[model samples]
Target: MSAGTGQRAAAPGPSTQKPRGIDRVLAFVERAGNALPNPVVLFTVLFGVVAVVSTALALADVSVTVPGTDDTKQITGLLTGAGVRWLVENLVTNFAAFPPIAAVLLMIMAVGVAERAGLLETAMRATLARAPRAFLPYLVALVACQAHMMSDVAAIVLPPLAAVVFKSAGRHPAAGLIGGFACVTAGYAAGFTIGSLDALYTGITQQAVAVLSDTHHADVNILANYFFTAASSLVLGLIGGFLISRVLEPRLPAYTATADAPDASESEDIRLTPAERRGLLCTGLVVAVYAAVVLSLWLPNGAPLRGEGGALVPSPLLTGIVPVLFGGFLLAGVTYGFTVKTLSGSEGVVAAMTDSVKNMSGYVVMMFVAAQVIAVFNWSNLGVLLAVKAAALLKSVGLTGFGALVAFILLVSCLNLVILSGSALWSLIGPVFVPAFMLLGMSPALSQAAFRIGDSATAVITPMNPYVFLLLALLQRYEPEARLGTLISRLAIFVVPFLVAWLGILAVFYGFDLPLGPGAGISLK
Candidate 1:
């Protein structure tokens, strides 16, 4: 099959433009990357490797002392009869109950209603269609940064929306698609406000910390990275806007508008009518009402939403974030649909939900194999073992201060090239990274903040991100010559600006040793 996107092969079309030095290098990189097997196959190979290695290490009697205590964990061989049986018994159940599986699918179902109702698209189109020419790029970047609140749906929705926004302003739709995808992926770990990501990331972190600590609890507040994330979002938007207008916009080769794209003359006329305007207002009111009801539950002492002892941070409200987001979208979508008459009755609602699932079929298939790999890795205790080793090596070198954080960020960045799923990568590394940092006097949130920087900065350049594949296909509509290499060259321009801004944000937090978020500090002490 093709790469992570599961797309069919294409016939050659227009000849490619000759490349210079970096383009040539990136082109070579693209060849090498695409030469590799599909992500599902890659993950399958990874599973086998983990299995073999676990057996070899176990046979060698390899073990490590858990850092905070005297207890030792020996590497368990997945090839052993006991190990194989354990894997067999839990394999199906593990995939069924994988944490991200439930969160992502639920988010899709909820946000799908908003999307299918046309509330999201109409509202965005209305706002961006009227923006000033110079201000449009910055505004799109800003919105892209905050789109994390839309959850997994953000990945599926924002690129096309941004394309329309650009096309409305008489710019290349392909530039909008490429740049929008970059911004959304780079903005994943960072947002103007807390979103579904924080909840999902926090849940994985809690489990990681629980593996090694009794004293230092991971953030119960989903706002753990909010302070850093919000700041980075603004920085990325400003710099991204500048680059988009000057760098990305100029670099795209000329192309005629495809049938899928509206002509320049027609695109300039894109706008919302009165009906859509009313629908947006109704949607806003519905969302507001939903938020008010949810918050009121948390206001009362020992209420259903609050945590133990009437605390808000560690509450069910915090942990049950996925459902809260689900409700908000469901209500907002239905309200907009009814107002606009796009949705008629209960049948329409169900049809909208069904369409959402149809869109997510690819993601669902990918997650199934991913779940199996993660399950086997956890069962083998390889993640813990790797973390213990990493901690020891880092501590021995006396790596501390901002340098330690930088090293960790860089490591994750390199790995992002191969592993595109943020949750999957975090889950694999968190068990090792979190506890190890805690041992070095760093807070779990600090390591997490560092991870956010790494996770986002390189996504634009990586061919492996499934969303990148999605964007590439969209780009090909206008420029049939646009291969992965050409797309990478276009996307690569954003990397330096993104990395510099993200690092600068991290440095501000690191140098001052400031709080990373609500009640979350840079160090445990």
Candidate 2:
């Protein structure tokens, strides 16, 4: 069961010769990303820029005709007295109502208990213990892809644990770290089932779509990209697993554990203890009962979870997904916690929830600035105007249908290198592209699918990704000399193939006219 039995020799050191094209590109990206300000500061700067630009555009009487409507909308300068008053009045409401914040926070609160209770750690150990050595890379990749349901927990926990798993199996821990990070970031938008991310993005998409037209409105269900993303999880798992074993492993130096490195001896004790086993059983029972109760409300005729006339798209289940995540995780976590002595009573559970909230302080600050940016952009009428103008420009150039879709995907992929936050980037561009694509006979869901593909494919290589730095720090535990370039070069090996494969999947979906999810399709009616 040793992963290092037939390991290849280490890759050669960096050449003194001039860097090639891709190396030069990555070096530039690393430098530029390092030079950029923190995301919160960047968003704050963007707010100021938007305000100044809005004033200038308003003074010039800049306007655009709304697509499918006779009315023309003019920019509203946010620096003006009226605009200032509106901003002051709506500041708190803006942050409170930024679609993703509440949903993200709620899910975190619930999943945090499970993470804090050692449930997630136990599960990973038990799963890895039974898996064959030869299949370890693929198994880790697959599990990491499916771990998207747990939100950021997987990204934070899996890399270090994977390093341990591989080190115990006598494999290069750096390769395991690389594999874990690649699957987590590259397959970020793909999952085996709907998760907080789906709810978060769907809300943003709904808001963007509502800006363009209301006549064709149906609820943008949280599962809008379910089938496509679920399929992507499998595709990425296989491809990512292969790249890690065949490509990344050979390139890494043989792992030599340091004092800070995870102890391989600890792997023997990773098995579930008696108490953890009991807690896991109880957690499973709780999840099953909860699922049965929820399904009872949705599966029967004329159920309450189903919306009026039994339409699943507009159902309470889809709209209420965030709360369901909170409840489900809370129930399972509490069950496991109490059984394992991680929670002695209600007070212990409350403490865990409080700690989770404390962990979100940084996110709260970022969202505060992001909210203002979004509100100012919308108030200025820039987003809608940009969409209309862009759509017109594309039509003038005859870039419609599939060509436009591919171009949009590439655009998003390039932007991902500079803009790291998926939600933040979507807020900035979603209004423009979602409506613009709809004008070209595509559905908002399809635009979202393309955007997700682009966003995820480049995530692992982007220095702007906050997780990239974290991954490097983790890598240093095994290979203290590991640098940003090292991780980026390793991850870049998979980025192109991952992008191509995902785009191909989208093409097939479009060609077959398959529904992206329940009541969601590739084209507008």
Best by lDDT: 2
Model 2 whole-model lDDT (C-alpha atoms)? 0.80
In model 2, the Cα lDDT at residue 227 comes to 91
The number of clashing residue pairs in each candidate reads: 0, 0
lDDT of each: 0.75, 0.80
Worst 10 residues of 2 by lDDT: 1-10
Q: What are the models' TM-scores?
A: 0.82, 0.89
Residue 12 lDDT in model 1? 49
Residue by residue across 223-309, what tens digits does model 2's lDDT show?
A: 789899989889888988888888889888876769978777867665678898898988999999999999889878988899888
Candidate 2 lDDT at 294 equals 94
The stretch of ten residues in a row with the least summed lDDT in candidate 1 is 1-10
In model 2, the Cα lDDT at residue 447 comes to: 91
Tens digits of per-residue lDDT, candidate 1, 1-525, equal 153222223534324544567656645656666776766676678778889998998899988776667777777899999898998898789678766566666766767777778877686677677889888888788777877766656777777777867877778787777777778777778886555467667756665665454344555456678889889899898877887888988877875877755456656445777898899988887788888899899988767888888887667876677788778878888999899998987888888888877876765666677666666656666766776677788878877677888898888988777666677678667777887787677888888888888888887787656677777777766776566767777888887778878988889987898888866888875
